[model samples]
Target: MSLSFTSPNKTIFIYDSTKTSEVALLQHVKDQTSKLTEVPINITSVTPQLLNSILTRMEPGTSSLLINKTSPWYRCFCEDFSEMNDFILKKTFVKFPSLIQTPIVIHQDEVYVNPSMKHIFDIYEEIYV
Candidate 1:
């Protein structure tokens, strides 16, 4: 499962809508992008294909980037799974989409997981300025 960006100039925002913080982040993204006249932004929910694409962009042993470590499901998953590999992580994410950390911003082939406000602003600057 991989993602091929048809337009390298576009930005993709992947987030879980159910999460309030993620929702806010989505809105923030919208607000920021609204200032740009031509930069295309694709906002989407966290789906299996998107998750796979995110995981592929991540560095090895960085599964934490994709997971909400504070979630109860994460705690239980940690206890049940002896290892934290891509397969297990993907299964876990698929089973509990809520457990996936979101507000992932993909721009210019760079993936930002749970990026801060500063990072978001920086991304916009990089794109529009």
Candidate 2:
């Protein structure tokens, strides 16, 4: 028997809850993808403020994580992003190098981005699927 996650039926769209514009874009992407592929998706616009709450909702080892840093204005996100990454790393015991403004895969669960969303989704699809 193989171990696995009991994934939720809805596809969650996690994002930096503080960024309203990004959230809107994420919703747009979800809408476009759903219409194109007929996938049942649910948008989960989350932020670091709800970090713990968000983590608690995920099924163990069932995350399709991505960290994107495509904007020049990222000093803001890094603060909360770093804190959130640290929290997850401690919980999962995965390690990543320090961020000098680059996106990375933290704890093998989350992605730390420094600017790569276009190809990142393709990467996410490759890994998760």
List TM-score per model, in order. Answer: 0.74, 0.29
TM-score of 2: 0.29
Candidate 1 regions exceeding 4 Å error are 34-47, 80-82
What is candidate 2's lDDT per residue for 43-122, written digit by digit as tens? Answer: 32223333343344445543323333444434444465545543563333122212122222222243333234565465
Best by TM-score: 1
For every candidate, C-alpha RMSD to the true structure in Å: 4.5, 10.5
Q: Write the per-residue lDDT of candidate 1 for residues 1-129, one digit (tens) a residue.
A: 235643566667666555677677667667756432121112233356756777766776776777677667777776655476677677777677667766677765577778987788876675544
Model 1 error, position 95 (Å):
0.9
- Number of clashes found in candidate 2: 7
Q: In model 1, which residue pairs have backbone atoms overlapping below 3 Å?
A: none
